[model samples]
Target: MWSAPTTTAALLTHVVRGAEEAGYNGLMVALTRNADASAQLNELSEEWTSVHDVTGQLIAVLSPDPEVRTAKIRYPIVYECAAMHDLRLVPPEDHDFGFNRCFVGSVHGDQLRGRAEAVPPRPPQEHRNAWTEAASRCASYFGITEAQIPAVLLLSFAERTAVLIRLRPRSADSLYDLCKQVAADLGWTKRAAELSARQRALRQRQHHLHRVVDRPELSRAKWRSRSADRLGSRMTDELRAQYDGLDRHLSSIAEVNPALVQQWRARLAELRSHGTVEETYRQLFAIRRHVIAPQDRQKWRRLAAKVGKVIAATDRVILGRYTQFWNLDDADPITAELRRQEAEMGRQGAEMDRTATEARQELRQIDDELNSVAAELGDIKPKHDSEPGLAAATEAAARHMLGQIDTDTVDGSAGLAGYTVRVVRPMAEAPVEHIDNSLSGTVFGPMVQAGHIAGGVHIHQHGLWARMRRWFS
Candidate 1:
């Protein structure tokens, strides 16, 4: 089972079989030898030539196994070449293969070939110093500290070379230009540009905020007159025309006294000065007390009150009618309504609590009576307890009967009458005298019989009462 190939032909056969088993279609042999060793080269060449044809034919054959049949078929040829020197030569202490030896393998058409070369040895100290110097230079150029040079050296040779190439200076105008290029490659340039733009925008916003804050008029105009002041200015001419028409109407009224007319004109002038209806109302109320003559003060007060009502109504129309300009107090209609509802709910909740307390008291009395009856009945042990086997058999029979009841209930295989017949037939044969004396045996026996009758009347009703009785017992 485990024999090494001893001859060239056996080795070649083994290699061919292995290649076939591994699903490989080709093989390459690269053995280092002296140029004078022609015999070994001829033997290997002959062995390959003999097996090459058969190997190709075997690889081309379609396998019956689905896994093998679906695989891509390859007609591979072997390349037997001898190296001119001993490429395997290395110090006896060095066992690492790829580190000391380099090999190049390639596949062409249906053929595979390879070449191996030994890496010449260098003094250990010199080798390490050269690598350290290269890593330090790369790390320094890339702005990495000297401490990170070891990590840089730990990378593969190709990766280390890539780092060196990246750090190498390109043709640029100056060091700053080179630094810009490096920053761009590292993506720092884009981030710095973004930060600079954000800083400029932030400064611009701060300047604008300072200018607004420094001027009180500007701040008030910006914040306070957002809507009404702007719209009011646009509608001022139209509103003035309407007021003028109203004044003309008042002038034409025959019943209006001249002094009252003059007073109303003064009010209109005050309205124009105030520039808002609410402010005009406030000023009118303040002036009303001192301005009117004592003889006409009562009538003028009534007229001023009516004018205030009209101004309030107009204000509601100009601003949104539904808008609540001030917070509601306890006297507000909505607040009054909410309080009334809360009081009604409190009264209803108290009534419900009283009713629930009465119900719980009644339930407690009923539970006490039931629990007393249960404790008295529980004191009487079953007579079959002295015979363990008989007691167990009785319990098993009860469980079986209950299981049958559950099955019948779930399957709906029998109506109430059928269930009653099945239950009563078994129970009628059992002795009612076995019931404890603590229970009224005569009453309980009849009640059990009545329950069977009720089961025939309605299975759901009987089941509900049965479960409740079981839980209480």
Candidate 2:
């Protein structure tokens, strides 16, 4: 309960007995209610100077000063005085244990006049009265009773003693700066009419605290600045670390998966007519092995096992160490570029693998074929010029033999207009030599206009065999 805000002083016994019953450390004063107790306070008064604003109030004895910490002192001590009475004691200076600073004094005032001597070191009763009135006015505007004020009041960081409120002594000002800034403009109304710049600054700080934390395009690095120290820096640090970690993962993936052949499968087709995607694919295509899934079923019976059906495809592929960096919300240039490069890298990496694999397989086949033909030719026996001869045949018989051995025919019906389709077949026993399509050229002379043939229409050349062992086996 609050004592009435009377200008008159509270009785000595009420202040001492009330504060002491609440376990105040004024041991000598609490033990004696006689004239001796007042004398003792008068004696110890030098060690702790009274803050004159409410110097005579029941609460004034409580000190929040570091040198004389009285934080354990609670107000409205329980008493058997069913005189139906109660009183609350408030300290002029609330003590600090761990909270951070609320403000700083003026640079010039801090340098020129120390906080203790900023005003008359020991303000006379008249000055105390004036300050008490100013504090009451300040409290009234804040919708708080003087008793409810949490920390010492201040004008501003730059102007410590410019106003009537001050809670720290100059000797201990540097030692005790950590006052929680719960209410900033407690006693700043001293120059409220003229200090436009200070008012703007205070308003700006208040507004800065209302920052958007979850916005997508927070590209500005303001959070890293010291100005943002009180504006949720700890949360920003954690979020930034997560983004960096995800970035590293994507960068690593990009490095290994660099762009290769754009559409390698399509390229291979425009090389192949081609295709596989992994180990089974390699076996099916590379080694030409049948890649069949297992089916455990009874032989020729209605007990055939059925393959399980896939009702729906999965919505997402598993990713490595995912975080907000993988989300589309971060539209910053750096993140977007990384995403593009990584996607391209994946495509190229896949194509390069397929193209390289096919090239290796085709080259192996070529090398084996070359070696086989060379070895077979090396094993051929030489023929003699004076070999035993059969009876000489007629030119007509020779021509007839040539007709069967080297045949050429044309089907004009199936050919294009003004052109005939020429077909040639060499006897199976004959060795491959240069093919002659001259008969068609002669038949169509100037009729067969411009033309181009990409390799052979059909490779009927023979004698070379057993290319790669892998192909057959």
Candidate 3:
């Protein structure tokens, strides 16, 4: 379509009629810049610019560019064609109409360019012949026909002459073939060089995309930095208004769930002998009553059930009487024995309380003596403030060992005997001690002979401390 502003109404009629004959669902009739129909179709052109419409089919258009008016505008048009054919224009965003539509333009280059200079005459037939030969040479170098050149070439020519010669490549497959031939003609003779290079560049881009997609650690760190944007800073906003409204609806409840913060704080404080978990759960449930509706007291009920199961399991593991403990249905003699034991425990507890008081006094008296004896020897058991970090470094070294289980770290060290595990906190009073035992034909021979050791007895722990000290030093 070409535009003389005076002829746009007639051109639009022709375009609309042609599109109807071609069975298009809709047509986008475009015009040159400053043309009479520009204002009439601005909304329509904007609508056609987006690829997807309501029905998930590609709406047909010249291209996203407002000036497209020819069949050779193939980059956007061909992609849109593929989408229309495949019905892949799913409405993935808002403001979508339907997916199947078309556009026609009636615009000349002068009007599009917003100029009134006299159009330069076309080159004579001699120039056309020479250019054709040059195009053929370029095409032959790339082992492609002249028709396979990309549409950008025509757009370049249009800019120079205001004469848009349509350029329609046969297909993407053909264009790819031409690119390969071009690379070969340009002396990239290696196998699939151009395609491989492009693929490598694309792969690098995709890898960067994958890194971004997989970066949860970085996301959490960024969230920490931007935490000032959190709810506390925006308590007067619409979001807060909605939150308040929701809170009003839930205000009649007697209690919400027991706060996890309080529970963890209690756990941190009470580091008594193991099996304290059951005691914690029991104390939590004793605060709740069964009279409340299940919906209101569901959390307490769940805690009670979980604690009961744990207690039942512990009894089964240690006493080998899971059913009797859970059902409260032991045999008569067993029941009698339990009752007797309970009574005896009550009496012994009182006696033990008195004994504990006296024992504390005695321990105070001998504390200095005990300290002197302990000072005479090296530390019996090392302590670590960050126990879990020490444990993790041990794990990392163990993993390293597995990779080198059949290989040595350096020199000719073999088996687990050559490694010694050690942990050093970032800033702390002392490092965790995992002494090696080189004498027992095992990794920790010396440590075992001098004294029994607990914590950090992994195979990779052999002699690692010496190596770590060497590295640190």
Candidate 4:
């Protein structure tokens, strides 16, 4: 389906032949201005003359170079003639097609035309190497070692300062070890004197061991404040504004009920600092039960439960490891095997907690759906119950009519006279229609005999009264 020819002429010839085989009326031929493409000029002349009698059109592409080199070069030429005997070329000044890249040569009815333009060159490798070398030298000048240069460049200066703690020389004398013995001894003595002087200056300020009694109340309040501050600062401006609004809402509540924020902060702080594992659980549950509304209580309860489970699971992991060690205390032969088993269980406990949390979330979603369905049912009750009211009325009317019916002769024919009178009473008794009359025509005709009505006309009389009452109501 595709071919890469050695020469532009060979490629163009192939393209032309392929186009002709494919039944094309026009051919777009592209050419490069090199020795490889020189053969193309002759090929194109031959193809043009051969196809002169044919119906197809031929177009040639050329580079912009006036003095074309053997390598890759493209530029515009101005001295080329426009009119010739065999083939005439029309040259246009300042064409959008730049000679720096590639140009087109069109041949149709002995008219040959070519246009050239310049193409943009790629940046050389020497420039990139120079920039990289400069950047590396600058990085080294700022105390960044070759090994740490990449991290220093990517992370902030504060982060770099923190990492520098590990990079500090454990002993200043170690650097001098590479020197001569006398020089090393002299350097070590000088460093010791300097360190002694520095320590003396620092010792004058305060005692090394002093109790740092942070007020318990202040510490707890700071925890919530810092957490909220971190949450806001990490967000974008739009989200920060939303958090600001929440903070304002809390501030307003704090102004009205100063204990509201204090209570939560105090409880949280106590849990974080002094409260035992079990004490924290009790405090959290107490908050959920007393402070939060019932509807919101479940979420807090779930959070507390999840946290408790995680803590307990972590403690179990440690306890399980300790149990393994205890078993190994009595048996030396399988100590390594027991320890491995303990490690395996500890790892699995964390994994199991993760799986349990995911399953809990899924069940919570199901619970929410069920609650929603119950609420929807409550909303649908009135409408669902109202639909059957008319049917009940119709059934009561039919029952009353059948009960009141008496075989009485009016004039020469035998007929029921009390049926219509009983219909009014049933209508008064049941507000909805009788169920029998609401049935199909065939069902109503049978019900007329069953009801002992004065023909089928009065069989549906109660139905009309029920419908009228419903319409008015």
Candidate 5:
């Protein structure tokens, strides 16, 4: 039995080739899709133009010359069985079908007939479902109901595949029986049943999906009431004012340019007569001088600018209405107050951060100076007993340390000065063995001890040993 293939093109080509080889002059194709059948047939004829006969003659005899034997050969007829409701739909009267004879027997003869007859028909319920689905799909495709295309089903066989055929009102029941017999002979019963079931399931799923996706909108009354609530008197007045302003501007421009109407009409006529869209647009620009008077061109320019402003105002009003209805804008008084407070807090936070950063910088500077002094003091330890210059160096270092403290105090870093005093007091108290009994030690030791008595009010003396070493060097 001939089993239908997945693609329409494959099935159509196979059937056409089979019919041609079986000595059929012309074949009628049943179209299931919503399309122009005649146009589709013409295209198909060209697409399958390379099919050949046993003697290497082009099998698609209906193709346009000069590929076919003659240009006079009639093309295959394709009809929308559901839409047309007629099998007698024929080609033009001028076309010849003299050599064409519709085949009733198998194209492969009895060679495959026994195999086709062995396959059994599907259950009645399956057959009914298949039939209903096919009819429903045909109706949906044409945007009609199943009742509009009420017709008995028929099957046409080619190879081992079966093509579903929907017959018109006048179609003979005997023809359907004959087709069934032909299908059985070709062993296409099981394959045809399977294809029909698949088609039914696909159409059902599509119908369900479409229904799910197509949600109904709110009623006109509800929509109108909601829009009215959102669009207050203020918005309406603004929109009306914008509209009136645009109208007044346009009126003024029109009054200044009395020839504008006549010029527009003439330009429109010229545009219609042009060969292409680009040419029409070019002519439109060329006729601008004829349309607008020289003195009124500036008025028109002003009017155009006013129109742009009016459009922008209208867009804003509409957007405002939608925003209010959807609660999309943060325009509530409470929200505005919150935002202002947040901004104030952010500014305060930023100022505090800046002050803290400056304080840290000042403190780091103080720590660096203290560390320098300590390093210089450590260097002085080895040389203090040997050198007499230790006293002058120690005095100089105490002077530098005191100067740094005064400078820090003047720069508004009094906290750094106090911290420096606390740091220096500890270093001054630490014993220096190298400077114990020497004259350098006598002079420097007292000076270093004097730094501790300066208190937190001033920063002094912890680098006496460092100065002594520098003096000796």
Candidate 6:
């Protein structure tokens, strides 16, 4: 049987209270790889949040045992951590939202540790007020109004930026209105602009839209010239020279025949159409090495040998090619080398085929063993539902899985307000140096109802999604 709720009463009470106050009354499951963590320090922020976890909480939380109960997470802080995740985390097994779980713990892939635990706590009113004052001071020092403060404020002291997440579960107005209201609530009035933006000094842009321009479309011949220019740019000088020589020599020989001229042009166009110029040249070069070069060597040998047939054939031939090119002598040295290489390739291919066959047979045997084990273990129902440890094991094996320490972890014993004295410290004389303050944030309106907060922490308010964008960044 599981232990009583008092073990985590303080952890549970704080998160549910904070989340409800923020209008996130929905049930949530918190998982972590923090098997040894009770508090998570943002390493960068040096912010300490307290955490409470049962030894093996993940499976225990999802267990269907009657003794199992819901474990509310530490709020606000965990949500900030969650926002860092690009995708939502769902455990391998279906969640028992009806208090079927009692614990949570560490998980690596599908493997579950002993039990589950959660972390986090929100900043209290006074700390919240202190944060507001600091932000106001930053805006004033910079000579900008509260509405003009960037979405992200990078202080001079801390290595990490201070992202202000104002969760106004109570307000429904534009982000601009919320900023103005926030300033008013803080007893300050200094807003220089309407919206947040990240300015970039260097950017590429299209030519002037209204001006007329003179430009002619390229013809096929122009494309061919363009191809040569591109080839020189892409390849080394020696390679381009070698290719140019080949093209000139081939053109001189092929000029004698109209058919040869057409064939050469078509080949050049095809080679130029795709891939790098060096790669295309290699295809033509390989044909010369493996085919043409050997033939020329044999012709030279035969001519030196004073063979009547070779001399007579040369007189009749058009530049020793343009027809005699495909005519192979079978005795070419490259031909002999290719035959030897083919025999070696055949043996390697046969060995690969045998290994593939053996692998297929081994896979079949493994499949049979797996089916046998699955049939035997399928009968156990209680283990699947009662024990989170087993469910984590089986579900992990099935597929998928793992999340954050929560708010209470941040609050520890002190409230969120007491957590930090002053978060907005300026560098030198500048109020805040914004690294990037673009409006790239994706805003989501109330996923749940918004009546939870009667009046907002600010006048017009922001919600969870906005809070995520602020803190997660």
Winning candidate number (lDDT):
5
Best by TM-score: 6
Two-way lDDT contest, 1 vs 3, winner: 1
lDDT of 1 by residue, 69-169 (tens): 12233211111120212132221212454322222111121112111112212332332232322333333323334322222110111111111111111
What is the clash tally of candidate 4?
23
Q: Write the per-residue lDDT of candidate 2 for residues 1-473, one digit (tens) a residue.
A: 11211111222223323333332111111111112223322222232332222121111222111210111222111121211233222111224411111111111111111112112333233223323333343334323233323113211112111111111122122101111111111212212211332344444543433222112221224212322232122224433343234334334433233342123222322321111111111211221111111231222111111100000000010111121122223334334634655576467767755655665565555456556544543443222112211111111122232244333333222101122222222234657787655444235334322244555465433344544444677
Candidate 5 residue 61 C-alpha distance from true site, Å = 24
When sorted by lDDT, best at the front, the candidate numbers are: 5, 1, 4, 3, 6, 2
Winner on TM-score between 1 and 6 is 6
Scored by CA lDDT, what does every candidate get? 0.31, 0.25, 0.29, 0.30, 0.32, 0.29
lDDT of 3 by residue, 1-473 (tens): 11111111122222323323322222211111212222223322333222212201101121112222222554335333332243322222123322222211122122221211122122223222222223333233222333433211100110111111112222112212222232223221222222333444444555544433332221223323433332333234433343343233233232543364354334423522232433432332342223133564453334333334433343333233232222222233233444655676577767756655665555454555445434432232232221223123222333332222121222111111122312111122356798775574446333444356656655554398979888999
Candidate 4 residue-wise lDDT, 210-233, digit = tens: 111111111223323432332212
TM-score of each: 0.16, 0.13, 0.15, 0.14, 0.15, 0.17
Alpha carbon lDDT at 159, candidate 5: 22
lDDT of 6 by residue, 1-473 (tens): 01112122223333323222222111122111121111211210122111122111111111111111222454222332332232233222224532212112111111111112232122233222223323333334223334423222211111111122221122221222222232232221111110000001001011211111211222234334433443424444434444455455445555345585456546655654544443443344343443235345343332212222222232122111111222234445334434544565466657755655665565555556555544544544433334322212222221210111111112112222222211221222336766653345576664323444565555444788789888989
TM-score pick, better of 1 and 2: 1
Kindly provide the TM-score of model 5 when superposed on the true structure, using C-alpha atoms: 0.15
Instruction: Tell me the lDDT of candidate 1.
Output: 0.31
Residue 469 lDDT in candidate 1: 94
Candidate 4: where are CA atoms >4 Å away?
A: 1-133, 136-259, 269-274, 281-473
Worst 10 residues of 3 by lDDT: 154-163
